[model samples]
Target chain A: MTSVADTLDVLDQAGKWRAAGKGVALATVIVTWGSSPRPVGSRLAIDDGGNMVGSVSGGCIEGAVVKEALAAISDGKPRLLDFGVTDEQAWDVGLACGGKVQVFVEKVE
Target chain B: MKLDTLHALATARTARQPVVRATRLADGAEALIYADRTEGALSTDGAIVAAARRALADGRSTTVEIAGGMVFLHTQTPASRLIVVGAVHIAQALAPMASMLEFDVTVIDPRRSFASDARFPAVRVLQDWPDDGLNAVGVDAATAVVTLTHDPKLDDPALEVALRSEAFYVGSLGSKRTHAKRRERLLAAGITDAQFARIQGPVGLSIGAKSPAEIAVSILAQIIEVRARRAEALQAAA
Candidate 1:
């Protein structure tokens, strides 16, 4: 889950998105393996308009996850997604070791 | 923001999202519109609003901050559940403690007398065999499984299933002698030494706890400690 500070920041962002009439989905990392940057409980919130908040899987794969979350909301299908940053491309997400993560993204509705 | 009613209405519209409202409990709370609001109290309005805004923005959980005190608004995000495969005395106490920690606790036992609601009023007590109940609930990393029944017939099959699942913490309550027997049985069942290590036999902390409540406390303490350590390690790795 995101921190109180981070949660508030994302909520503020979500509020703005809501005022602008954007649909938002929240993604939470429920599990991780092998030197993952973020804890299993880390969270990320993405709006239908592509605005984002929170992080899961450190910085390695949040971009991709956010895209998936936005798409899930638009499509009205919640999904559990997984991504891995391997040692060969460890620097791709600025991760040192090969780490894999599983995230659950669902629409608030 | 000065209009509590307007602010409450605005927040209620977005209540579907995990929202936390930090309001000044000591002062400046006159602007708080919802008397039904779950509050995070802070000393000042600035700090309270800042904290409340932060919790709202994250859409993960909520926190309310007061100057000297902070009340965290934990929006009820679904957390992992825990299933105990025994209705032993320790399970009686452990179930409630686990529930208090926010785990959806369920106890399974084939003995109707052992798994009664009166014994564990707060927990979901099921008078069924282990495998059936666990399969129904679906154990995973989010779920913690513990076998408190010393009987091999009760614990063995349940443990076998738990070993195959992604349950983060799988422990059994027993003595050294019982664990040795269990190890031998697991080996016969094709479990490797590595997999055998997965079971936290002789469950609970090293603290010498004699009573059922004490044992429950120790066991829950270990779970909390392990979870906290895992979170820290993940953060450091990040």
Candidate 2:
């Protein structure tokens, strides 16, 4: 489980990125099924430059999520993404734990 | 997400108050909802505020469909606290173990020699009577009180305060006969039998714990079991 300090750090980083005029997006693990690495409510904050804090999926699909988060930042729209081990590219990203995860990515306005 | 609202959320977290942050998915508008009041864009709407309040009461973060869009309510509750009312050997072991479990631990003892910082390095040590120490610390629902002194003068006063408060766990260290006598004293002191039943005498899981460290492990294990079971029940109800 993530400590309160960790959660605060993610929020603090998002605030700092926004203050610096950097486009920011927040990705949260809204739902998890089976043996997903991170629990529901885990967060990852990403800035325009792809700098990020925290983790929504313990490094398994973070790269894909970050790519989507950057798109959300540009469009100022929220996107809900679903990923599972059944996907053909799951083995390439290391999400072979036979679990499904849904992440919500939104611009931190 | 206004800077003022963010500041208020940080302040509430520092003060250990239950607070919820509701973020609207459509426009990214945010609100800070406290037990008494709310601050920000979503504060004025009764429906959103009520939903946030329900999330806070559930002590979990969740998404709810509102009028215009879906809002994610991130509920943050205060950290769990464990007050060990006796700076004894078991407490020395128990305090650190409890800290590892993410509990804010405080060791209390009236004896200056025992309650010294040297004994409880990196732990909050209170050199005062049990009742006074507990009062200063302030017991609440997220708190657990354990008396290890085995002395009536020390353990009884602490139990009196703990039994009356909303502490989730109240434990006392003693054998069955000792607990029997302690029960009589508590009954005479106006503690009802129903309330007295809350005290876990011989305080620790019966793991045949022989050493102080082993006993501390057992006690911490029991506390975790109780907390997990309570959370499971809450989840089931929710």
Candidate 3:
């Protein structure tokens, strides 16, 4: 379950990283279509060192979202990313069939 | 996401206040919305604010297409509360389990020695008597109250308060005969038949549980079942 404590833990980790002067980015699942393992508001916090916590599409799309988050941290530009079997990358990591998600990555300043 | 916004959200969660994070899809511009106030440029936008409030009411997150762009409303309400009205051995097992499942667990007992930080390290241990403790915790629609202290002195008062309030699950630990006696006593004390029926005496799914830990598992499973059914009913009504 995506409980409140999980959200607090993720955001607190991001805050701590930012306070420690580590560049941090936050990735949130803004939309989910057919059989998303995680819900729409699920989040992942990524630090500049490539350290990550939490999940967006459980596992299939996380590696891709983390890459976007790291890039967002470097450039300070937000990105809205999409992944599923239909999209390019096809996840080939396998969302397998429909399970599409729209993830928004933003730098935590 | 701004640090101050993140900090404010942490503060709201600590305070158990329902809050919504509104993000504009076109730009990732953000705002935090509380029932009484709003925290960013979108504060002036009635449509998004209303959407955020609706999100809070249903305890679900969603995306809304308002003019200019799309807005995502991520609603975060306090974790559901579980008040275990005893610091008995079963509670020692149950409290941590409930906490692991993200319930804000509270162990209430008048015995300070029993309801101590040593016993319930992860959960709040309230040393107040049953009635006082339940009132202090404040039962709501998301709250679950269980009486694990078999003694009527400890369990009945808590059961009375739980039944009168909106707490979604009211369970008392006892045998079938014991529960029959309990029903008689509560009826004498003026609890309605319908209200009396809400008490799940022999409280647990009939899993043939023998040990305290096993019983705790059964109770937790039953609570989860009740919560899911209630959520489905509420969604259907909506």
Error of 1 at B191 (Å): 1.9
Model 2: per-residue lDDT, tens digit, B70-128?
78787878878999999999998898778767687889999999999988886789999
RMSD of each: 17.9, 4.3, 2.6
The positional error of residue B213 in candidate 1, measured at the CA in angstroms, is 0.5
Write the residue-wise lDDT of candidate 1 on A2-104 in tens digits: 1223234444555556567677776666557887787654667688767677677656777777778778778766676666664333355455447776666
CAPRI-wise, candidate 2 is: acceptable
Could you give me the TM-score of model 1 versus the true structure?
0.51
**TM of chain B vs. native, candidate 3:** 0.95
Model 3 alpha-carbon miss at residue A32, Å = 1.1
Assess each prediction's global lDDT (C-alpha) against the native. 0.67, 0.85, 0.87
Cα TM-score per model: 0.51, 0.79, 0.93
Residue-by-residue lDDT tens digits, candidate 1, B1-238 = 1223224434554342334433222222323312234432233345555554544444334334455543333232335578999998989888877866767688999998899887877667888789888988788766788899899998998998888888878889999999999999988998788888988879989899999999999888888877667656655665
DockQ, ranked from best to worst: 3, 2, 1
RMSD of 3: 2.6
Q: For each model, chain A TM-score?
A: 0.73, 0.88, 0.88
Interface RMSD of each: 17.4, 5.7, 5.1
